[model samples]
Target chain A: MIEEETNSRREFLEKSIVGGLTALSAASLFSSCHGDDVKETGEKVKLLSPDGTIVEVDSAYINTNIPELHLSEHNIREGVPGKKFVMVIDLSRCKNARKCKEGCSKMHFLPKERSYVKVEKMQDSEMAAPYWMPMTCFHCDNPPCTKVCPVDATYKLSDGIVSIDNNRCIGCRFCMVACPYSARIFNWGEELYGLNDAEAKAIPDHDACSSHKLGTVEKCDFCPQMGEKNELPDCVKACPNGVFYFGNEYDDAVTNGDETLQLSELLKTKAAFRYLEELGTKPRVYYLPPVNRLFPFKDSEESKNS
Target chain B: MESDFKKEHEKLLDLTKELMPQKFGRTGVIWVISLVVIIAIGLVAYIHQLSKGLIITDMRDYSSWGIYISNFVFFVAISLVGSLISAILKLTHAGWRTPLTRIAEVIAVSAIAFAGLTIIVDMGRPDRMINLFIHGRIQSPIIWDVLVVTTYLVISTLLLFIPLVPDIALCRETGVNPSFWNKKIFKFLSLNWKGKKSQFFLVHKSIRILAVLIIPVALGIHTVTSWLFATTFRSGWDSTNFGAYFVSGAFMLGAGAVIAAMFLIRRQYKLENHITDAHFDKMGKLLVLLSLVYLYFNINEYLVPAYKMKHGEAEHLNDLFTGHFSLMFWSVQFFGMILPIFVLISKKGRKPLPAFLISIMVIIGAWFKRFLIVTPTLLHPFVPIQNVPDAWKSYNPTWEEWSIAFATLAGACLLMTIFIRVFPIIPIWETAEERGIIVDTHEEK
Candidate 1:
């Protein structure tokens, strides 16, 4: 009986994969010809909402609100369940081109002066090589920032993402002080010039958890919102050199938008290490040390003097 | 010889009449009006801050906390003087502490009140202050501070009020004829004090219990404040010595503030017989002792860390010892600690005028020391600051920040001044008892 159930489930998944692809194509093709003529067919199909409620709707209206459904605030804090997400950055591929920073700023609608992700030009010692280091919130298992928040406004979720609830945050900025990486940035006042309110409201909060109020602290959320739909984070997609790889640790697979690799093999082969590992924060983000350079390190305007 | 004793008895009555809470003269009115104006300006600036957020202040991501925090420390330090003079000195049976106790308690009550207010001013969302109670976790140092500060304030007020009961009765019986409102207040506050044996026993016993209670709570308030910084992994704040360091420094400043208050009260009210040069001499000796203890902690706070020159401590120590903060740092060390210690240590220096000057120096130094403690360490976080505006890399509190911080100081002083105007700066009942006055039962009002 168990074998029979498993066989039926596998067969249903296989059939749905084929049917779903065709449905996607048909929706895309017919969406442009919207005059209510498609509704005259009176054909209804069963569909499941993102929150798992099934409804019988005409096929044309099926995918209209699909984008908005995945970006719910409830799921933003709950995060992508059963998945321990992680990121790895290849230092060799980075040559001081700040596209990742730019992409982060753009996706989060951050002010030019304040970007959640900082690209630091680091040199370990006088004798060591200087390299461009892109630093964002490591989303550590033991996040000191969340530990210090008086209101539990910033919290580490079960699925390996540390996020802030701006609505509940009392703007004490203790988290900013607690962060060793200096990854957190405070919205000091009203950000009037960047994304307007309507534009911000239109973009679902889960995209990067972007809409922030003055006095709240903001940091990179690792784009779990993007992870919900199997899409790469904006920074991973934006990097011209494919410097960032993001994936699920449970699945043991990671991707840099263009290529997917086995997580264990890549980390072991590349000798990847987490930043400030001795601090014992246990950051999910890893880095492949700058060995065998793809391009020579060039000092960008963001790079400060050693 | 018998006539001489009667003359001394008459002199004591005259002292009571003189020490009654008098109406403020023209100069007092001017002083109060100026403080009110300053506070009004601060309120306006705070309104602006509320509308604009904390952006008006120079605090940024790097320098997340600034003068508001330091000002908070200063108020908490000054408030500790109340506990020191009233509770600690009383417990130790120090005779000279009687005249200074009321002044110290007044300072404690006002400074702690403003300390609570100043912290709220520092909070980014004052509106969500209730959340402190709703979601307050015991693990956070902030919750500890709130618990202790509130506890200290209540105890400190009771400490002040319980002793004032007999003084209020004295005011009513001596026919000082205070204002109608003042009379009603004193009448209600006096609690029908006939000064019977049982009442005296109950009041003294309650005071003794509170005095013992306040010592731990006072120590807790400053210790928790130090923990707010020390709990962080930042280099300068990451010290095992911070709690003792803060407590020691607080006692030194508290003593300095009490000396200043004593000098002013003696000079202003002309209470030479009550608050004599001997009082100043004893306080000066106490000041010297506290300063030496604080200076010892200062060495431990800075020198021991500098000796090893660890990776994180190197830059922060360098900044204080020789870098941009060096000028302010050296001045605070010399004027705040060293000069005051030297001046107060000598027999000639312990005179009223000289001791007052040294106490002023110590108080000023203590203020700047708090600023140094809060700002410099924050500028040098564990991670090197990068990719930020030049302004964020450094902090200089703007005019609004300055106005609000100074207003809290002025407000504390204003509260103390009003308190003095309402009640005798010296405890009349204690003073009379010390002078061995006979107590008549059921005295006519």
Candidate 2:
């Protein structure tokens, strides 16, 4: 069922990108050179354009690389339909290895100095036992950040993901102030790592929502692009100890790439609780307490060195 | 009897000459030039900020707001003086404020204008500023702040202009025009105040109505500003007392600003006869009462949080009381609130020079007090500050931020200087009426 949904969504994403590519081709054809009629050659390179057309291209012209689909600016707000995405982090499995953070940063093309997901050493008080808490956007149902945004730039979608439209964002930072979790990070300068021309051009329909810009806020987006490919989020895939589970509540299943579990059964068994529950934020992410932790809490050598 | 009339006419002419807007002397030229240079530099820095983004400032994920916000708060605080002196005083029948009303109103107008500009300066994408109006959500406190601030600015401008019409006419009609530009402005602004009995009645009635209308709007402006922070759930911001606390503190700062402006105008124009020792004494008493009330709110804001010390509140309170912010916290409380109250409470301290000196201290203290209110609270968010660059952990504003903030300050001063250059700082007709000296305008006509 999950595979079928993923394939159909992938087809939908391809159609949108193909529409964008056709517009691109139309512009290029008007300005420069491109053939109007389809032609076949002995090379017969098969090309599956996002538009869902299986066309024959010369071997020299065939570009097999399937770049991430950049949806239309409007569709970025719609999210994946018929989905209520949720994350469950089993605290007992985390030892602050930071593989999850590394994978998340690499996948999101974030600057080295920042991460979408952070592994924090937390102690409720001086007397409480210390534990590693990997934190990111709660994607809260009652997102304080979205509520205070005067421009409606950040919004909670029906599918339980709160996202920002950078083009619409005025960079007032009021959303940052309203958020209790401190999940949002501002792009203070021009994007440090510029995309290569080919890569940039590949995303013909780049939604301003997914694009980061100077003076805008950015945060974890649950790797919605990866989800379209029937893959778990980067953090879920990269966790060496299977600490993170990403799934849809509608599907009633979550997978850590290695193991899949029923969302209700796992929560019932683990007695999962959301962070700062009393704040009434109604977070989409849940946490299992650090009961029977895998490794005794110790300051990691990397954190100490830094 | 003919010789006596000639002497009275000469005396009135001399007084008018002394008070008329004079061309900038060498010192005034230098002051104007310096202000212009500073404003130019600030504009350059702001352009740099626009191109480079807010990353040029030291703000990060942890301390999201820095000096730009604090500078905005200071501007909002100082602007309140217009309402306090003109509206509150006029409503209460304290006619002694007549000389200082224009000065207070000018400060209010200029400060509120810059308050609007400074908030834009703080925005990361000022290009998208139109979104605030177009996509403005009434659910947000920011929308409320925008609405109230714009309302306050409009009302303050009208308040300043309505009272200035008769004075502008006086300047124009009295044959004391220093320049052609002065003549044109006074002629345009005067609205033909013919000194008819009916005109005075109309002017008096309009001023009365506006004075009554401004008080609630003035309160609304600062209350909405406080709501910007108070609506958030951050440990330092989640206070029910914030609205009243902000209002009381703004009143104190506004009074201090008016007192300082009064002293400078008195000395610069040598209008000691018009300003008077009695005016200084009355303002001193008012300052003391305002400072005491603000001090009570200060106690209420800090003491209750300190007592409860809920884990989040405890860390934040400790940071303010005895931790990193202690030095600033103590000094602002002392110099801004406590010292001013102590000095103004005593009879000797109510003298012009001492009162002026104390008022200056209070105003300076109040600026830093705003900084303390904004920056320190932001540093102590619910989540502990960690990860990212070490620079993000503690905020210290960059030179670009300081330049833009200082430029706004210079801009406000320049506005005041230009205002006084064109129009008389003190009301001419109102003062003459109070002293039972009817100016014989028929001779000039």
Candidate 3:
């Protein structure tokens, strides 16, 4: 069955390679013939809308909207103005469900085994009870990774997001060694994700979260592309138990899709703390201690297999 | 008095004849061929790596650096020999250093040159190496390393070349049965030296200046290399004594390398008179001193940390002391440091054969020592390794990494071999001058 699946995948890739070329020429030809009159066939078809609802639409109404390009390279380096993004993970609610990991991998187009966020089982001592902690890039205010980068490939932006410019990364991996939390991941080889080079390049740079260059470093980017539209990151939206809360520190407001709370008040009430806070990295991500847990801790399937 | 003068002139002639560069014999030809073959294989592996990525090596996200980086550190460590022998000894007026200075400089140039190349091989994107200069941040220790390594290379090349000018002039004048092309190369490189008193004075002045200038630069190179690790927050790497630790270790490795080269060159060229047993004995003493200094630093670096056994450091120390890497760790310490000190401290062991064997052991041990320093620290990171594939937790270099690493070693040897083939390994003019046989250049012309 696995061999058969691989054979079909290879066949699909081969067809796409050929079909992609034809589509490029056809697109140009259709653009050149734009002034020609169109005659509606008066046909209706069932289609899946963006919201996953079935809809019957006239053929004339069915048109593809090209994805809008946002954030030039310079603009990405500058980051979103007047915003300081932060995150607070509520450890009490987390029970290793792993929906956040799944949603993050799906949104980023990563493979099943690779993920930006990992849910780990943590026990302070042998006698203490274990709890599930979902770990992601802390995006420290004083990022050690950026300081050790030989080239200015990784940098801290004014908006509190630590960003990487893969185009400029020399792939020395010094930044990886310098990161105390092991937040960075290296692209040791090609990560095509089923798209050919040209097809991958066709996606806009800001929106193509998973089209990572070979031999560069990548990590959780806080879903800045979605931030432009004032939407939450995929992991924040995917958690059923509201384990993750993301917000703007400047506005002092944070949300977990189900409720919004004052960031400072919540932190003070919960006695939140950053991981390895003594390192003086000043991480933007905070974690509330797992007190009065809502769900019992259980090992994840992935953890069990390992 | 007249007969004494003629005798001195004839002795100078014999000295030049004995010291001139000779054509390669059967063994030399085989050595060159083997090095070239190794280099060719390495080139093939590097090209494959370029087309693919660093995935050809055993490195992963957690164990991000492997043998290539360790090899780079070894080269950098060995290159420090040039500064130690030529600069420090020369400044101290150690007159017996004449025969070994050129050898030390050649080793430095070749080792450092390959040191730079090995780093590029370790990089995931070698093609984007230009970005290091284009977008270089001065704050990065890597940039400081690059700057200092380049500076040391230039100064070392000059230190090698300037003193060789009078020697090259001798090679040009005597011809030495060199091929036509070699004759031209020698004549051009000689820079029209008349060996006048003024010329000798100028050479000595320049040599003195470079010898003095290279000391701090040499220290900078190794200290900055140490900072590459020390500046990081990793438990094993973070320490105040790292700079002194690396510098002292580099000196020991450098001395070992020089002793090994001295023995081989003495055997190959049949220059028993020039590189005598006394040189070996003195070098043995020097190696013992350096090894002891390095051992002292090693204790300071490891013992204090082991005693405390901080939260994250306990796991790393145990892994070295009694865990998975215990074998390699103990072997490197004993063979690379303790055993060498024990063997070289005795008069019998300071003989050419035993010293050579022990130096070879030191070299091999030094290579693995670097590996121990780099790989183990990475395996035990601050956070526990979990949720990833088990393979990512431990590092084992593949055949490609080994091949490429050996190639860099072979490449450094090949460079030195070619250098010895072209230029006199022992400076002929300087040797004669030291023996008080100052022949008149104008009268000979």
Q: What is the C-alpha lDDT of each candidate?
A: 0.83, 0.81, 0.85
Residue B410: error of model 1 in Å?
0.5
Once fitted onto the true fold, the runs of candidate 3 whose alpha carbons sit more than 4 angstroms away are A1-69, A191-199, A207-211, A301-306, B1-10, B443-445
Q: How well docked is model 1, in DockQ terms? A: 0.47
Model 3: what TM-score? Answer: 0.89
lDDT of each residue in A113-164, candidate 2, tens digit only: 5778988777877988878889979999999999889888889887788888
User: How well does candidate 2 match the true structure in TM-score terms?
Assistant: 0.87
Residue A298, model 3, lDDT: 74
What local lDDT score does residue B412 receive in model 2, on the 0 to 100 scale?
92
Q: State each candidate's chain A TM-score.
A: 0.76, 0.72, 0.73
lDDT of 3 by residue, B14-104 (tens): 7878888778889999999999999999999988899989878889988998899889989999999999999999888888989999999
Ranking by lDDT: 3, 1, 2
Question: Could you give candidate 1's per-residue lDDT for residues B1-445 as a string of tens digits?
Answer: 5566556546556667978877777778898999998898888889999999998899998999899999999999889998999999999999789989999999999999999999999888888888888887777777788999999999999999999997787777677766798889989988998866677778889999999999999999999989888888888898889999999999999999988988887777778988899999999999899999999999999999899999888999999999999999999999999998888888999999999998999999999999999999889876678877788899999999999998898899999999988888898767877877643333245
iRMS for model 2?
A: 1.6
Candidate 3: residue A105 lDDT (0-100): 75
Docking class of 3: medium
lDDT (C-alpha) at residue B140 in model 1: 71
Tens digits of lDDT, candidate 3, A162-256: 98888888889999999988888888877424546665566566553334778888888888777655679999999999999998898899999
Better structure of 1 and 2 per DockQ: 2
